[model samples]
Target: MSTKIKANTDAFIKARVVKGYSQRELARHSGLSHAYVSLLERAIKSVGPSTAKKLSDLLDKELEELFRIEMQPRP
Candidate 1:
């Protein structure tokens, strides 16, 4: 099983900015790599459940507000 997170880019960036967290800062506080944070913000990469929750919590936003999560089964 694979889960993909499609982030609401505008909301994600806005929330982070509103919270005064830069990409690197957010990543550091979230215990995620800065590269991954950059990729996620650019929609170049997707995150799993735990990572998604971490970001949402750290950003002080609802999970559904920042991301559209989908679960897909690999063939």
Candidate 2:
């Protein structure tokens, strides 16, 4: 939809695949809902910092490594 929701979708999918996890499995591990994980994979929802941290901890990835969106520059 809106520009294909580009925030490391590919990497997230890859990580999930490498870990042999289904969307439901990842959601369970991350304390998120299965529908929410599906939305993220389909690029229908953006991952916020808290969610990212949860995924990072569950996936054993650094928060920065999970998202590639450029951060706003400090003023």
Candidate 3:
């Protein structure tokens, strides 16, 4: 997978885990399906911009932080 994709996946998983939330719990909080969450974690699907925003809102993080491209520098 590309570095950006890997970074997004890693960030998503790490954020959720750090919050002590399971996939199911994150799905519930984010209003995304558990299967969709699974697909996201596995990098089988790309998360849409709106969905990423929702996840950021749910996780109380900046949307940019969630979907950043690794090693590209952050503003």
Which predicted model would earn the best lDDT? 1
Q: Alpha carbon lDDT of residue 19, candidate 3?
A: 88
TM-score of each: 0.86, 0.73, 0.72
CA error at residue 39 for candidate 2, angstroms? 1.0
- How far residue 10's Cα lies from its native spot in candidate 1, in Å, is 0.6
Q: Which segments of candidate 2 are over 4 A away from where they belong? A: 1-6, 70-75
Candidate 2 matches the true fold with a TM-score of: 0.73
lDDT of 1 by residue, 6-69 (tens): 7788999999999999999998999989998888888788988888998999998999999987
Q: What residue runs in model 1 are displaced by over 4 Å at the alpha carbon? A: 71-75
Q: Which is the winner by lDDT between candidate 1 and candidate 3?
A: 1
lDDT of 3 by residue, 30-60 (tens): 8889998898877676666678778888877
Q: State the C-alpha lDDT per candidate.
A: 0.90, 0.74, 0.75
TM-score for candidate 1, please give it: 0.86
Ten-residue segment with the worst summed lDDT in candidate 3?
Answer: 1-10
The better-scoring model by lDDT among 2 and 3 is: 3
User: Where is the poorest 10-residue window by lDDT in model 2?
Assistant: 1-10
Candidate 3, clashing residue pairs?
none
